[model samples]
Every structure is written in structure tokens, then in C-alpha cells.
Target: MQIVDHGRVSVGCHVANGWTVVEATGEMDIFTSPMIRAAIIKLLQDGHRHFVLDLCPTAFLDSMGLGMIVAITKRIQAHQGSLRIACADQRLLHIFSLGGLRKSYAFHDSVDEATREVPRHNGLGRWPRPRD
Candidate 1:
């Protein structure tokens, strides 16, 4: 796991053999959302469509952050990829659920579980199987 600091925000990236887990901390409003967006996009460009974003440490999130998530989800879907979030905070979970995004993205409790759910690199050529 490697942590990259972008001033107010910190992005912790855990790269496994096939998956990449990003743990974001600090505020994710209009100002810092782009950094998160870019980081995810870069991974996508690197042919990593399966992702797990751990937002447990995130203090706050605004519309822009939510929008970025939506956009990333769409991008992943477009490529027949998958994206999940590990967020245990009730407030953030409430916002995601109330916003109707709960049905769109899978939420997990830990990075280990998230990565386990994601398929291996060889399986990326095909769309993900439905979760049980």
C-alpha cells in the first residue's frame, strides 16, 4: 500500500496482482474531488476496470464527489468493468443510499472482501458475474 498526498487530501493505493484498492481520506468536495477522479481515471486507463474505493476515512463529501463516482461507475460499466466501495460511515452510506446509488455500486466493509469479490485480470475480458 502506497499513500500519495495531495495537500489536503491523501489517496492510499493498495495494488495487488490483479486489483487496486484506493483508500481516500479528508474532504471530498469540489476542490479535492478532481484529484480523486484523476486517480481513478488513471487506473482505468491502465486497463484496471475493477476497483474498490474505501471511503471510510473520508470526513465529508459533496455533490462533485458524488458526481465523480457516478461518472466513474459509468465509465467502468461502459468497459464492462466493475466498481465497488467500502464505506462503513452511516452518514456517507446514507447519502449514497438516499441518492439511489446503493443499487448502482456494491458496498463492502473491508478492502480484503472487496478485492476478493473482484475478478482476476484474466477474467476482465468478460463482464462481471452478478453478485449473490
Candidate 2:
């Protein structure tokens, strides 16, 4: 795993069980959103289909940060990719829930668990899944 520490956040990435786990640490607000977005975009361009965003250490997440996640989700879906999110902070989880995003993607308890469940790719956004 290669870890790069930036001014406001430290980003780390590694491949685990065929899934790319990107660990982001620190406040994820307007100031630091671009850095994270660039990293994810690069990963996607590099042909990584499955992704896990480990936001366990995110101290704060503003609208820009949420936008980044939303944009990435769209990009991944367009490429027929999948996404998993691992966030430890209950407060931050509540923010996602409030935005009606809690059920849009799979939320895992840990990054390790997310990597193991990379094959589970539910449809993106609020689109209804076809009844089986």
C-alpha cells in the first residue's frame, strides 16, 4: 500500500481481494475535496472496477465532499463498476442517511469487510431494482 500525506488529509490506497481500497484520513470539506476526487478518478482511469472508500478518519465532510462521492458514484456506474463505503463515525453516517444515500450503496463496518464483499454491486442511486 502506498500512503501519501497531504496538507489536510492523508490518502492511502491498495488492492485487496480484487477491490481497490482507498483510505482517506482527515477533514473532507471544500478545501480537501479536490485531492480526494482526483485520486479516485485516477484509480478509475487505471481500470479499477471495484472500490472501497474507507472514511473512518474523516473528521468533517461538507457539501463538496458529498458531491465528490456522488460524482464518483456516477462515474463508476457509467463504467459498470461497483462501490462500497466503510465509515466508522456515526455522525458522518447520519449525514449520508439524511441525504438518502444510506441505502444507495453498500455500507460496511470495516474496509476489510468491504473488500471481501466487492462482488455485491447493487444498482446506483435511488433507481428501483428489478423485482426478481
Candidate 3:
């Protein structure tokens, strides 16, 4: 179901199998990160752990946007939860690599694959993340 709709981005949540898929469409920058951040935090507070971030429709992700994602990931890790990102956009994938975050997080080709009961992950979790 759709959760929040802001000018720059829209956040939606759906149950796929046993996991929750949180889809974000449109640009996610400084202007929209706060809203997304709040929504994710609320989900966390509500005991939603594992997440599938369907960023297929997300067109842009600035520094603030990337930072928000990293922050949320840290929080999820703190809770022993996992996050899978589904971003087919080549630009975003390239940005993830350029930002030195490719190994820090897991990326899937589609949301369907990402929202599986178990998210794929490597044993090592020592990658550097964006600073707060």
C-alpha cells in the first residue's frame, strides 16, 4: 500500500510473499530524503525489519539521498535486519559504484527477487558508509 506521497518522491509499501517491499518513485534528494527517512524510521519502529527498496522508478539520488539510504541501512543492521535494493537504473547503479558503496550493500535486478524471505548478503560487513 502507498505510505507517503511527497512532491519529489512517493513511498509505497507492499507485502510480497513474506517480505515488505517499499517502493520509491521519482527523484530522491535533499528535498525528499527527510520524508523517506521518516517513513523508513516509522516502519522500523513498527517492527518491520527486512526491506526491499524498489528504486526501479527512482530517477535521481543525490548525496543526501545516498546518505539517507546509508543511515537507514546502518539502523537496520543495528537491529540485525537486512535491506535489499532493486535499482535497474544504470545511472543509479553507476553512482553506487562510483560512490564506493557497491560492496557495502546488496543490489538486485528486480523488486520481486529482492523481496524474498531471505536477502542475499556476504559475510563481510566492513564497507565504509556515508557519514551522517
Candidate 4:
């Protein structure tokens, strides 16, 4: 994993089970969210269609960070790809719920669990085997 430490935030990535797992650590706020976004965008440019964003190690997530995530998800879906979030922090989960994003993403307890259920999306933008 090539991890890039951008001050208070660091991002690393690796491929597992045909999905690119992007692990983000440290605070994700207005100043640090861009680093995370850039990393994911670079992967997308490199033809990575499936992704698992592992945010378990993240200590903080502000509105900017949440917006960045939503934007990334939209971009992935536009490419007929998918993005799943692996986050176990209850506080973060609650934030997601409060932001009305619980239905917008597949949140997992771990990266293993998230990668195990990669959605098999067809060219028509439909998942033949819906992931749990």
C-alpha cells in the first residue's frame, strides 16, 4: 500500500477481490478532504471501477468531507461503477444517518465484509446480484 500522508490526513490504497480499497486515516475536514478526493479521482482515472472506502481509522469527518464522499459516489455511479463505505465508528454512522445518507451507501463493519459483497453491475447500470 502506497500511503500518502498529507499533514493531518493520510490515504492509502490497494486492490482486493477486484475492488480498490482506499484506507483513509486522521481527520477528514475542509482542509483534508481534498487529499482523499484526489486519491480516489486518480484511481478512477486509472480505470478502477469498483471501490471500498475504508474509513474506520478516520477520527473526524466534517460537512466538507461528507460532501466529498457524496461527490465521489456520484462520479463512480456515473461510470457504471460502485463505491461502498467500510466504517465501524458509531459516531460517524450516526452522522451519516442524520445527513440522510444511510440509504445512499452500503456501510460495512469491516473492509473484509465490504469487499466480500462487490456488486456485479451490468452495462445497463443494474446490479444483477445486489450486494448486502
Q: Which one wins on lDDT?
A: 4
Cα miss at 63, model 2 (Å)? 1.5
Model 4 worst lDDT run, 10 consecutive residues: 122-131
Instruction: Provide TM-scores for the models.
Output: 0.81, 0.86, 0.87, 0.89
Model 4, global lDDT: 0.83
* lDDT at 60, model 3: 93
Candidate 3 lDDT tens digits, 1-132 = 788897878999977765668889998898999899899889889987778889998989988888898888887777666677898888998888887887667688998777655543421244355323
Model 4: how far is 38 from its true place, Å? 1.1
User: Taking the candidates one at a time, how many backbone clashes does each contain?
Assistant: 0, 0, 1, 0
Query: How much is 118 displaced in model 2, in angstroms?
Result: 4.4
C-alpha lDDT of all candidate models, in order: 0.74, 0.79, 0.79, 0.83
Candidate 3 is scored at a TM of 0.87
Query: What is candidate 1's lDDT per residue for 1-132, written digit by digit as tens?
Result: 544577778987876535678888898889888888888788778777777888988999877888888887777777666667888788998877677666556788877777775464433233233334
For 1-132, candidate 4 gives per-residue lDDT tens digits of 755687798999999998899999999999988888888888889898888999999999888999899888777877788788899999998888787777667788999998886566722154323334
Ranking by TM-score: 4, 3, 2, 1
What is the C-alpha lDDT profile of model 2 across 1-132, one tens digit per residue? 645578788888988987888988898888888888888888889888778889887888877888889888888777777778898789988888787676666788898878774454534533323223
Query: How high is the lDDT of residue 102 in model 2?
Result: 67
Compare candidates 1 and 4 on lDDT and give the better one. Answer: 4
Residue 37 lDDT (model 1): 82
C-alpha displacement of 73 in model 3, angstroms? 0.3
